[model samples]
Target chain A: MALSDVYDFYRRMEDENVILSFKGEFTSELLTSILHIMETKMVTMGISPKMKKRVFNVLVECFQNLYHHIEATGDSPKQIALQKSALIMVIHENEKIIVRTGNYIPSNGIEKLKERLSFVNGLTEEKLRELYQNRLLKNKLSSKGTAGLGLIDIARKSKNKLGFEFIEINENTSFFCLDVVIE
Target chain B: MEILLLEGSAKTPEINFNQDTGVLELRGRSIPENSIEFFKPLNDWVDIYGSSPKETTQIEVRLEYFNTSSSKCILDLFKRLEQLDGNSTEVKVNWYFEKDDEDMEEAGVDYEAIVDLPFKIIEVEEI
Candidate 1:
């Protein structure tokens, strides 16, 4: 990257009020450090405990979702590259906090993910709670160590609809982006 | 039965389950990457405790922050508590949340709705 391009990127992030951003491997230790930084930032900004908890809960899921879903497969060059392919950003938009995550996913799984996101987005607050409870009670954790409640929990905590996109990167992998807004 | 004691870390919560006294206390943050793995022992303890529980069992939950996986494991733990014979064992849950933490309070309320046992939502200055 050239100095001029780097300057433009820095200016763009500043203009967008990007409080925190990361691109690379999503490890549990890294998530803990990110949460630590955000907790300090919220406290320094004098955010109320209620607001801070909401942001904290949603942020935890955002990174954990990335950590669990970003499958590295084997030690191929492509798989190694996938380790650094993920991105997460915490931005301040108006009075709300917007958390965005982007990562490469197998193209075959896009339909299932799209369905899940759309189903979560189509519900009202009351319905979302109902769905969350139902899933909590009925589902068992998969072999991948997920109860599949991350999306529902994000929507419930934020009390807003989930926004997402599936962009085709190739025949085998596609870029998936999730947008969560905390008011 | 022996006391089940586990220290809390950044990802796991502190667990102190006394089988003889039937006073189970879980405190601190529970954001484990794999909640089921961490909570299995507690759940198993509850299963064993249910066979011969105290006349009045008291369970205190003081979690500051928990992830979605831990949320489910918490429910599973409570569900196991519900299985004790109500006639012989009186199980009560005291859920504590700090001031200004409405999400935690609401989470307590949600758990209250699901479990069959009597649950108390307690407000505290800090956890």
Candidate 2:
């Protein structure tokens, strides 16, 4: 089988309709460019103004997560390597916008990620609202990295399940794909 | 009193405040790397301006986007203005949002809910 065949199978199983595909070094410039393009498209498509903001907000959070957790090796081998990766966005027939982002994840980080996803996925809408309000009241002044509330914010905004899949690339690394949908 | 103008970056917004005219404006995105560090001085300036209240103080906020932390700081700023209600100064807040941007309009309403001040939500065409 060819590489496209593998991608096709995975795409079918994930129930994603790939409308845009990109693969390159995930630099800050590239991320911002992508956001700008997406925002333009959202406006052109006549998406509601509220939904446009929501889409942009979700994109920023997801891209930041990929940047923070990407694996790398060099002079600073253990440093979070700002390497290139593949990002795919799909618009489902049901009017749901799905974003699939893939990046190299350290093998040891899988369990922690799973735990966080599980905790976020278990919350009801009311519970998530309470958590958000509580965080706002008690933790607004805290810095971003220190709080690690990005995942919770994503969960609350998306109002969808966080679906993830891992492919073991080698013993020390794995290609992790995260799927988030905005309906 | 001096007018300090700052441009917006990928993380922050453009800040324009004129002490002479008492016209303060913040527009564009706001997701600064450090929320407190970025907003502390702005808050301080508002406090200083509130002391010797101007005859007509107008604050225009036309932010396209801001993170939750920045939202709190904005609330604090509005509260400060609300405190100067009976003073000789006439304070007015004009929150501008895109014509179809309901999220921004709702945010304006949310800020209005907390402060007892003259706040107006204006819809503008996207430039």
Candidate 3:
């Protein structure tokens, strides 16, 4: 990354109205600190309390999704390297805030991830609420104690279909990006 | 047994389970990195509290935010209270939210739908 390249990226972030953009390895400790920063930032902005709460909640779910997915990756040098470069960006636009995260997913997992995203985005509000309720009752947490409720909750909170893309990085892995927009 | 009081941190909720007063309170943010571990003792406390009857059990939840993992643990805690509700123990959950926060209020409503316990969604001027 050249100095000019860094400046260019900074300019682009500013152009996009990014409030925060983080690119690095994500650990549980780092997640807490980032959340604290976000909370303080929201408070400083003096946005509506309800809006602040919505953005904060969406950010938490996004960070946890990244944290859990990264932890699930086995200890391969390449995977770890890829994990360290994961990106999260929070942008404010058109009276709405957008929380976006990008990370690597093993090729085999991309299909399932896409399907789940599609399923969540496809549901009507009533069905989504029903699904959330049923999942709350029946969805057993994985060994990591995540009940796979992150996506559904994000959808519910955002009240928008999730935006996602999978870029083919290589034969064995892909870059997965997810965005939730909160109004 | 004894009262269970755990201080809140940046990532975990404050838990004050008073066996004597039957006023169990969970407050602050609950986005702990290891929510299962953080909430284990609370679950165990609920189990013990459920077994021993109190004339009235009141749970006050005033969380600013919680991640998905913590949400599961919260449901588990509420389930324990629901169990107590069945056996003649008057269990009530006072879910508090900031007056401007409809999302938190809705979260309380979500829990109310899932758990068969009486919930009082109270809106305060500020948390």
Q: Best candidate, DockQ-wise?
A: 3
For model 3, what is the alpha-carbon lDDT of residue B87? 84
The lDDT for every candidate, in the order shown, is 0.87, 0.72, 0.85
- Estimate, for each residue in B8-101, the C-alpha lDDT of model 3 and write its tens digit: 8888888899989989999899987558898889888888888786889999999988887888889998987888885857999999998877
| Residue B78 CA displacement from its true place in model 3, Å | 1.5
lDDT of 2 by residue, A23-126 (tens): 65666676667777877777777777667677677777777666554656645533443344556464644777777778777778888988888888999977
RMSD of each: 1.9, 4.8, 1.9
Clash count in backbone of candidate 3: 0
Q: Show model 3 residue runs off by greater than 4 Å.
A: A71-79, B86-88
Per-residue CA lDDT of candidate 1, range A100-135, in tens? 999988889999999989898899988888888888
What DockQ does each listed candidate score?
0.71, 0.34, 0.77
Least well predicted 10-residue stretch by lDDT in candidate 2 chain A: A74-83
> Where is the poorest 10-residue window by lDDT in model 3 chain B?
B80-89
Best first by DockQ, ranked: 3, 1, 2
Docking class of 2: acceptable
* Residue runs of model 1 more than 4 Å from their true location after superposition: A73-75
